[model samples]
Target: MPPTPSPSPGAPGRPPPERRTDDPSAVPSSAVGREFAFEKRHFDFIVGLIHQLAGIALAPHKLEMVYARLARRLRELRIKDFDAYCALLESERGAEEVGFLVNALTTNLTAFFRESHHFDHLAEEVLPELRARHADVPRPRLRLWSAGCSSGQEPYTLAMVLASSIPDLRRWDARILATDIDTHMVETARRGLYPAEAATGIPPALRERFTRRVRENGDTRTAMDDQLKRLITVKPLNLLEPWPMKGPFDAIFCRNVLIYFDRPGRTQVIEKFSRLLSHGGFLYLGHSESLYGVSSSFRQVGPTIYRRV
Candidate 1:
């Protein structure tokens, strides 16, 4: 899961999207089992489009998942069948709905500090080494990227850790870049608002120092403090596309985002990360993901954590 809340589209470890050209139907077959007619061709088209757009490779079994997530859009647009839906996507005007399509299929499942050990490593090991290395500098510069920041939680967590670990944080040029392919999640992260319950996973001291409770209308919510917000810049970025920013980031947290991509796509992204990272910078991956047989640019330093070699 990502920090902010972005697409955790489907379960991890399933096969990559299947490529099939044997059956090509412009219309749905005569199957009356569901609310919408989701033919294999429709699924295949979707698979191809999503892969092209976002680098997410959908497995063959994701047919139901794709149908279920996109069905609401069909209903909202008042489209009748999968053929029509696919046709619309192929249309010139379909460009607008493409964003919505990507958003709909993407799910952001995250917590304030979903993976505690990573934060522990950041606090205990990473920052200290950086501080020592930068002691001669007048103002140390630290940049971290929450690459798949879902809603906002991950980068905010990074901010908290930075604030607490570095006593001279104000003297350092510290910033966190939080980006997600889902613009909806990027906006959500920019707002820095979350249900009060989401704050539970955050450590008590960090939460108290970095977050505040706000009552909007009749509902209570948690808002990140300006101090923490100052350290983050949230933006929408597709990992597979051309990047605008120059990097050499001190660290990159791209947790749980790679599971949706096929091996080649995953390898490409990681290599890009490696290129953008500082020589000794760290790379963090989701628990179920690994760099094994993917790349040799990093050396494993901790559980799912890597240091650039």
Candidate 2:
């Protein structure tokens, strides 16, 4: 799919039908004091829609958070209440808003080498094993997938580590696929510009080599160097949808994303990853996620890291 464009702030192409004012279902009296009329029905629709669209299962506890996040959209579009907002989502005209809605609701919390140990393992163990295994290929290729890579940090970090580990990196074919369901985040990752503080987690040497400070709109920001950018391709991808790439990735980093999915959803996604992975390739998950009952295709080889069996 092509990159999703940002939604316009103007009202939807066509106005939603005016809901009956007297209907209790349209606007609950209890919502009278709130900034927007967010009833139980509206929350339910959001939960179901996000799950169907992104495979994210939001709990009931996230009701307030949902309202808080989506409320911004309401204000932006000049939408009166959740009733009209949900109607717009359900209508044909609302298709464009879908991207914005998903962008708003999806959580994007990432940093440069946020999970330090994963990179450590990649540099020390995984790279050595792959290096020895592909020693004979005329032009050995290395492919990695950072599934759910938010704002490009994970894949950029992967690029830095991959370049650092292999002395003949330029001689070999190497690419990192960075993807996220959120189109906005994909755009941000493509830009490869970040606040200076965001680079603190990266080692000083790597940071100095792979990134540089630039003035953007009068503020100094860190921009990823072309050397690092060349190794990564960022795209908007919904994991729940059919993937377009044919992959035999040497390693797949899908950290933290599975925590939002239920057991069955998690299993299905893991199975797809297993299919894309090269034999015995590595799969990395977040610290809180595990595949104990999700699949038997992998064996625990390190902390939250699995190797295809």
Candidate 3:
């Protein structure tokens, strides 16, 4: 009351020595607030960790892209910072979180009969040769693996090729094992419903054989027919995880999946694919990818195809 005690120096009337909250730059070195601000060090650590855990390399320039995808998880968890979220990833609950990260970061760019040349080669050269080779073997069986098959296109393409080219597909034990790291993609592939645009490049004959049209509320819709759908089995597969399908496959289509992996990661995956292939089996990579520097286990058979050597 005596002039409010003259508002004593550094007292209630005055600001409290520019406290951390009021001036972030003035925060004590030990205060966690200073560390909460985004730092390049933390960014690099996250990028490296993602590469290690998922074989998906998030380049330095993609720091914003990573933040855009993962920030939602941070918010959903009520986490105000990345450090705490990263630490949480080290725990058992982190497994699910890591799965989300992997799914988000992976590039699932794929379509029916992508790299059309591969399908042509399969129909004309590979399948014919396989049939001729197995003609003498009773109950001819063929196994093809579409590793990193996103939303069923590659495997569905494989099925279409097999169904069209194979003379006695009904009698043959032919199957395609389609897999991807993303569970959502796997489930979508299993549904076998594709937009009409997806069938644009599909040859008319193949489309007729593999797809059926239905009237959906006054609109015509096309979907993969039962026969083709029956030929492929979609499953969730993480290339970073242990191989679940026992193989000796006639061919393995792993197109476009390795571009995200570093040299060592790519090499490890190639080696595993080589082991899965039957002797003389073919391995097809994406047009932009190669096994040349990555592995010596496979010999180049075509621009994007390899033979287990």
Candidate 4:
């Protein structure tokens, strides 16, 4: 009999294809990249560590989501693996790395007048009440804080409401202090530019008064009109850090930001917000969040809206 031919590489008759290791550190070139096999341990460690450090709790089920968000940082920093990335997070240069992590991990879902009810409350209830309280005061100034203000929408919305509803806004010394942990967002808010879609829910009269249309690439950019823009001053603020503002704000819109924080962090933030607010001022949380049992300083006034008692 002629010599039996050895089975060709990957031929059916050959020994079965070797199983690939699913481990990220051991994946072969022909196998899918390690990014997809991001270790659950790594994810758990990072999430737990972040929660411990900053009180941001990323759930265990968010492993894949977290990997997708932070994998780019690994590539950008030329790091080899998640472990190495975690090491970088622990180093002396960790502050900037942590910032990148925060930027990547934090959800920034917002639009102009999102949760329109809050704006309605601001216009119909809060602002009127604030004005009435200030009526007897000599200066009659109104101060609003949009804490964790993402890309400026909430603060800008507040400004528009004030401009439209408050007479003599230019003379009243009214101000909206909009702050976010992300510098990029702060700068974007400061620019006061938004895509036209952001204007959809805004009333036509207010849109006309508060937004100016400019064309670029045959698309319009709605620049917030000076009247509204002048009311908001955007700044970079870290909720985890000591607050820079000395505030006795009439109202605060800290919507959607506390979802990332754990119970203790949320409580701390609520206490801070309560302290920042004037007696009888308001605190607006995200629609999905509530202040029940979080702090004694606020009394629930509506769904996700609280009054400082």
Better of 1 and 2 by TM-score: 2
lDDT of 2 by residue, 1-309 (tens): 544334324312323455676876775454566798676667777877777667788998787788889988899999987778887887888778877888898899998898789999999999999899889887899999999999989999999999889989987899999999988899999999999889998999998888999999999999999988899999889887788989999999999999998777898899999999999899999989999989999999999999998
Taking all chains together, each candidate's TM-score versus the true structure is 0.89, 0.90, 0.81, 0.84
C-alpha positional error of residue 189 in candidate 4 after TM-score superposition, expressed in Å:
0.8
- Tell me how far candidate 3 lies from the true structure as C-alpha RMSD in angstroms: 13.2
What's the lDDT for all of these models? 0.87, 0.86, 0.77, 0.77
lDDT of 1 at 127: 98
**lDDT value, candidate 3, whole model:** 0.77
lDDT of 3 by residue, 1-309 (tens): 001112123221112222345655543344354424444545666666566566677677776667666777777788887767767766669767767777777778878777888888888888899888888777788999999998887888899889889878887889999998887789889988767778876888888778887766776666888888899988887786677678889999988889888787788888988888899899999889987778889888788988988
Better of 1 and 4 by TM-score: 1
lDDT, residue 262, candidate 3: 77
Q: Can you list the residue pairs that collide in candidate 3?
A: none
How far does residue 170 in candidate 3 sit from its true spot (Å)?
1.6
lDDT of 1 by residue, 86-173 (tens): 8787788877887898898876989988888999999999999999999999998999999999999999999999999999999999
Residue 108 displacement in candidate 3 (angstroms): 0.7
Kindly list the per-residue Cα lDDT of model 4 for residues 1-309, writing each as its tens digit: 112234334322112222356545543343255554455456666775556445577876687678778888888888887767777777789757776776787777788888988888888998788778667676677899998898888898898888878786655779899988776788889998889888886789888888888987889988888777778889877676677788889899999889888787798898988888988899998888988777888888888889999
Comparing 2 and 4 on TM-score, the stronger one: 2
